[model samples]
Target chain A: MSRTGFQLPLLPGRSPSEPPDTQDRTRALEAKGASEQVGARVRRLFGGSFHLRHVDAGSCNACESELKALANPYYDLHRLGIFIEPSPRHADGLIVTGPITLPMREPLLRTYEAMPEPRLVIAVGTCACTGGIFAGSELVAGPLERLLPVDVYIPGCPPSPLTLLHGLLLALGRVEEARR
Target chain B: MQLTWLWRGLRTGVLTTRYPRRPERMPDGWRGTAVLQRDQCVVEGAPPSCVTVCLPRALSVEETGGDRRLRLDHAACIACGLCVAACPRGALSISNEFELAASSRARLISEHRPKGDRAA
Candidate 1:
């Protein structure tokens, strides 16, 4: 048997023929003018000052696990001047994970609508950015861009903690400065 | 950022799975698939315990004249390990061998019975 070509069966009730353009337009709109706004806010919140909020739409828990790992002693996201807030009102950015399942669409919209203006949205994991292997499933409503504007995207089956941190830093414009 | 990059580089080596080529290692107590021992099966009309434990109705027992027959549907199995535990005669065990890939789904089904053990 050829293991190289095996793929899990597509989730039930998914369309195999949907155009990819829908996702692209949404992503482009999200990326525009987002970095600049987030960068300004992050600059003011340096040194243990900013808080982030996380939402799990319908992920398999892999992405959420990695996100929580950031808070562990080894990663210590707090040391980088970042913290995860429980509420949208108190948050500067929204970290979203999962494939945005059908049942979660309304709740996700409600969460995004509640956040204050100049708020940044970061889509983490392949499930968030492209819905990964779940894209066409009836249970999933999106690649996230379909419902909410995404400022940054970090891709992986479930991205490593550092990859997520780098994405957050990119959104903050901290990595660019550090690059030079 | 240089410090972050150095830390990231060190961590990247540890992530990802080398699956497909090598048999993927499942977690402890992972239910792979059930194997049937033909020798332990009774050729008589005695009911097999595997039939009762399969939640998905993936297994069936048949009687041909006087022989007992057991059939299994591999695809319908969720690898729940119930049948393995239910086999009272030690005719069934759950094996770690998961590479049951087939070009056709029909090939995945399996049947077990003692050879030349005619039904009464």
Candidate 2:
């Protein structure tokens, strides 16, 4: 059977409908005021190309889903020069999700130590930030900051992809810093 | 060539959000952050009813300088929206502001003391 494919020629560019205001607001909110120095230092070291190592200390997997979305096309985190490295040895930053579970404590610590100097540990999701709803659970080991010095706190049951992007940008000093 | 993929792509458009610059368009049931209304809590009653229903126990009433104030740990909150719905006096409600990231843990905490109830 012979068939003709329908084709339309359109300029290849970001869709015009993706409203600019919302994205700007999210960026404004991600601005960290006091970390200006840290961000600048980090940017100089990595040239804004942040290599992240993700670890799920102990979580319900909600955070992982959002974390994965960072690599999706719409978010296009790669365009910003951010990447998820498979090994802590190659990573410049550790993006942790979930509450620090009892068993994962050792593993998490090892990952942090494995990272190179000028390293950053970012606690993404409410769980990693403050134990979240799992705080009182006997099986939980509390927040990540209690164990490792956290550089950035992205608080949410699970932060949105844009929030994650902004948090990374904040850490690298791509955005303005604010205190609040 | 079918070119069906191109047609599908054009129809679906971009699925990503334009957040940060403009505010996110949260759905009807989408739950955001929580805020405590001091005056409303007093009218409903001290040690607000929402505290009891809070699953994570993230909300607690503490006596500061002889005045009972509600403390909310934003990091511990799951954003389940239970407290927001449980409040009889509308003292607790979920805000549209979802960007809760901060450099310090202290910034995530919110304390609301009853209006006009000065600590001695």
Candidate 3:
């Protein structure tokens, strides 16, 4: 069977400790079919695909850098049927980074309000989840969850590119999971 | 040309990580998260053993009626290897568990009771 649309660059479903099998074609075929079905369902949820608008809510720029790396050849998040969009109006999801400061509170809400129905809010990095080291600050107003309905909370100082991919996949799973 | 780049791509195999779908191990000595080896912990000292040395305060000890419980908040942790080095009994060390994404706030906090106090 040919998997034409399957382009998950990361070696999913295979353990590194296990030696590579050259004669396990049947087992490999079954695994591929399962992940492909999941991919197809996820694609249908957003009507072919969806766009994400990332907002830096007064972050230290570390999360932003990791977010930027997703588009590069190494990570390549676009291959997974999701994209980084420029406009909130065109986006179906929001990837928020850093602790939301007083100045960013109004803009963040405006961006969330701009998105259409079935919108997803993903809080990336430690600051965005629980404000990390910047919790209970005088200038800060949010940890992303307090202001919006966050679907996923990726807790890391600056989550690695792969972690962001996993979070996006989890959010996609949630959309389908909720409907069921 | 685009064709030349395409040829270069075929030469260089896939480099993306396989995490979440499958476990990915971080490099040796890589500080992903702090772990408190409770069995090795000498609970004879006053409460808040390694909590004072923690820079982010991810480690904390709450003494409720003489029972000291060391709490490690993964959300607040910055992955700094301070607590591992600061432990006088050498009970703390770094582990390769970096995929710590969660949907709720309370799930991120973990508690470790010393050998004798297992009630709480």
Query: Which number leads on DockQ?
Result: 2
lDDT of 3: 0.70
Q: Which stretches of candidate 1 lie over 4 Å from their true place?
A: A1-32, A44-48, A177-180, B1-120
Q: What is the lDDT of residue A130 in candidate 1?
A: 59
A85 Cα displacement, candidate 1 (Å): 0.6
> Any idea what lDDT model 1 has?
0.65
**What tens digits encode model 3's per-residue C-alpha lDDT throughout A68-102?**
89888767777677798999998777889989987
lDDT of 1 at B100: 36
Each prediction's TM-score against the native? 0.49, 0.76, 0.75
Off by over 4 Å in 2: A1-38, A41-46, A176-180, B1-29, B43-46
Interface RMSD of 1: 16.0
TM-score of 3: 0.75
| Predicted complex 2: CAPRI docking category | acceptable
User: Between the candidate structures 1 and 3, which one is better when assessed by TM-score?
Assistant: 3
Candidate 2 lDDT at B83 equals 90
What TM-score quantifies how close candidate 1 is to the native fold?
0.49
Q: What is the lDDT of residue A177 in candidate 1?
A: 19
lDDT tens digits by residue: candidate 3, B1-120: 999999998998677754444566667875556777768875545644578777667888877896777888876777887777778788888776655666556767777777677554
